[model samples]
Target: MYEATDHPDDDVVAIGPADYPHVRQFVRPTRRALLLASVKERRDGGGEGSLYLLDAAHARRLLAPERPVELIPIPTAYRLDDLTFAVVQGLISADNALGADDRLLDAEEQGLEQHLQRERTVYAREAVPGLSQVGAAWLGSRFCSRHALRWLTKNGAPSALWSRAQIGEEVLPLLLFRQQHQFIDEFTKLAAGGDEQPGVVLCVPEDVVAASPLYQRILFFLALAWLEMRGLVTWVCGEPEYAKSDEFVLVPGEQAVIGTWMRAKDNIWSADVAVRKAQVRDFDLSVRHARAHSVTQGGSSHARLRAAVEYLGLEQTWGTLPRRCAELGAYGTVDMLQSRSRLIALDEVDRALRYVGGLGSA
Candidate 1:
């Protein structure tokens, strides 16, 4: 009842609802696989395809390992489940199913999904991919918690980084303006911009925030990205002992509040929408770049975009980000991502990130 057509520049493996449970089992451990699954019902039902980043080796290891599941293969990439397989494109190596091209710089040889792209250098990849919230916090902490603590105890992010607001105004992708064409350079512009764009204040649990500078940086960017919004994020098990070590003011928000998730309920909802909104921006950027990358080039940009989405943990926002990117113009937004479901104070929704963890981790 459903078709698994690959996105023009992306390497997708589409499945059905019956495959959900099977896929879900791999969600936590594998957050790096780009999967599309749905259940067509007797009524008007639709399927949702989320892109997950995969640890090619890890993903391959996690495969059924039975060998030769009966499925057709694609020319670009191969698909293998409990059934057959196919090769859709070039270089669908047997060892790394996700394909080994990490750190995709010139997507020119890869492919194109569009004519032009607002080029930008991503100084670094997503903060950390393929991990649970608590897991992310823990990883973040060991990654120079002392420095992160210094930032907090010192009263905030290095005034240099925090005071200089970056990102965007409508709380969107002002970060991708083609002129600058590099993340840090453009971010430098965002920071130097006179007025702060409206951004939601994200609150991660103190322990996790202190534990991870990358985690703190993510939240820091969130605060600097806000303009007209007054939102709050709550870390469920925040430890006040680390209060002095929690200097979020470094990110440039209006005010800082240290209440529990209970007091920040509305703020939590508002913040989730804010981040979901930004994810939309990132999604649009990826798709456009993918089109610009095209099939002639190897269609890698599309694949990379899908990976980036998973890396940033925006899987659920998949459907909205792509569609909104298309039908809506620069100013258009989505109604669905604005869910009222009491999301976590941090980006802690129980969904899979679908990307490999520790690609660049030391």
Candidate 2:
């Protein structure tokens, strides 16, 4: 958790654990990451997503904090990629005043427009074939209008460009090539039968998903979900991050990578969520609007009682795995990944809400 003095304008820096020495020791060219606010798409065929690596300085300024922002250094052995740079740079720029200020907004807006025009021209000449120059312009225009380009290119928007670029570069390729969808369609066709009950859509949890190629396949998930709604195969969501369980399908295709993420998700459980696993640390210090009140409750109060019961239930059923792992002294980074995954799980969220609801009912 962050300290109380952190200011809103302060930078929230994150480096891989490997990169910590660079910030701590001021070593050579250590890579660090910062987050900007989230962004949404503004055009048709556009879906909600995030932009990244646009403007770092601006992000540091706009998202002020209550404590001095610290950089999170990641482990160096973790290979870096081009997409990482694209994300970090875009996110940083998103937090800048140039993005939000109305006075200079037009200039920034024009620059974004020009960048899109250039990218489209490059894509047409380099990406599409058999199109004459004039024809290419028309085709590109049809693919994305000036209005759409303007919406996508606006640099200040968080995650807008990130998600679009990802959709364009990764998801569209998979969908258009029919590489993965062939399997999806096959499953869908199989599901239309009267005797079939389509199984859960299997996937690694989001963190593992983020680390894996599946991150790029988010669009594929969305598209397939739509297909499933039309009587396609059922999409059962799975956790690639945890040990393969009977209730979920394990994604078996990730052997190509080093399996670092898989190892991370299977780490031993702890009595509480570990300190290093704290993903969101809210630091709010504004003097309340004179309407703040403190509410006290006992540990066995309705909220705690239900959460404890549900948590104990999960522990009783699934506890053997973690307990066995812990007995073997297998604590490691996977604990962090698993805890994070649980924090984001739909089932976990629903369970928590139900627990709270039960408390109110009681």
Candidate 3:
């Protein structure tokens, strides 16, 4: 049993476990409410609503603690299985209300529906092999790309412009550029203030720091943001330009060690050890700005590697490059990169590699 609270905004409702004695008979002992609490406490000092739709045990495990709960303001039941259906349907409804062309909207809606059906089939199985680890990484990337596309559309960007753009020749470089300037602007503000202590653990949830490879990627970005905020690393164009003096250590909260058969029993490493290892290498992280050309399977290994290296260099001084391309409608780039399975304009691979590589003129 549960209690429901209504807000002025009918779309947002709060439901929590009921305290009534009779409620125990209706609810199962193993069942728990899938609540989404804020990582950061509310500034108003008010408690968050305990609204939750029941989820399966497996689905519950996927609920990341660091994930900010975004309630979709729709009438449909918010279940994990129905999430895609709910969101896509909501988008379709909005488009219809706006008097958009039915033909264009119908085509896009059908494509989204098909993808959702495939995803549903995969998740419907009782136990998916390697889903907990490998699947999370793949799913996270897809989610990030989709979320970026949704962000653009919701913010009033025309979807058609980016949806039809070439991935390697247009989208990849633009995303890298957007991310670069975001870091630059943030770091500049921090540089104005004094530097902080070297060794500081980022304030992420314990589960987030140790969860999955996807969370690890998120943690990496968060740590990078923290480092940038302290002005610990230098930026040439839009990428972190490491210097000999630029050295710092970040420790994640609640350390745990897990071992695989591939490694020796005595060679176990904790989360902090990994973070330290990343720092020692001067954070020479790979840049995969787009899915289409970033992965080896999508393009020639040699070309992708060269492009990645060149992109890193460009980040240091190629600040305005992405902005220039974006002015010509790079908004739909994310959708094309993630949603489209087949690689496009493979012949442009060599040309794009040379073009991006040659852009390191600064």
- List TM-scores for all candidates, in order: 0.20, 0.20, 0.19
Candidate 3 residue lDDT tens string, 122-179: 2221122323221222232232233223222121211001111111111221122223
Candidate rank order under TM-score: 1, 2, 3
lDDT of each: 0.25, 0.25, 0.25
True-vs-predicted CA distance for residue 53, candidate 3, Å: 7.6
Summed backbone clashes in each candidate are: 66, 52, 6
Off by over 4 Å in 3: 1-5, 9-12, 16-220, 227-266, 269-362
lDDT of 2 by residue, 232-266 (tens): 33222232322242111111111000001111122
lDDT agreement of model 2 with the native: 0.25
**Model 3: ten consecutive residues of lowest lDDT:** 158-167
- Cα RMSD, each candidate: 21.8, 23.8, 23.7
- Considering summed lDDT, which 10 consecutive residues are worst modelled in model 1? 82-91
RMSD of 3: 23.7
* Global fold similarity of model 2 (TM-score): 0.20
Backbone clashes (count) for model 1: 66
